[model samples]
Target: MEKLLEILNDIQPDADYETCTTLIDDEVLDSFAILSIVGELEEAFDIEITPVDIVPENFNSAQALWDMVQRLQEA
Candidate 1:
């Protein structure tokens, strides 16, 4: 989870999960940020993020993103 948190922190250092969740829920994440996160996750974890996996809930928080990465790697 530390790695996930680190990745998220690199993206938005001042953000907490609560803030990130709200940003996702409110459609405040621009396309560039979303793509940047996707790229970072793929490179960091060596996991493929398909279109089907690109859900707001999945990227809403560091924990949620970690769970998704674990699930994907497990699969």
Candidate 2:
């Protein structure tokens, strides 16, 4: 979770990822930022984020991202 936060902070330092649940809805992360996040996440956690996983729900907040990472790691 800390690493996920670090990745998100590196990509967008302005947003409060810890409590920001409207990251996608509020446009806190643009398309490029999302892509960068996906790349960082995949490389950091050794998880493959498929197109199917690229949904607003999964990228909404730090907790959601952390949950997705854990799920993928178990797979």
Each model's C-alpha lDDT?
0.78, 0.95
Model 2 local distance difference test score: 0.95
Q: After superposition, how far is residue 9 of candidate 2 from its true place, in Å?
A: 0.5
What is the Cα-based lDDT of residue 36 in candidate 1?
A: 85
lDDT of 2 by residue, 1-75 (tens): 888899999999999986789999999999999999999999999999999999999998899999999999999
The residue pairs found clashing in candidate 1 are none
Q: What is the lDDT of residue 18 in candidate 1?
A: 44
Q: How much lDDT does candidate 1 score?
A: 0.78
Error of 1 at 6 (Å): 1.0
Which pairs clash in model 2?
none
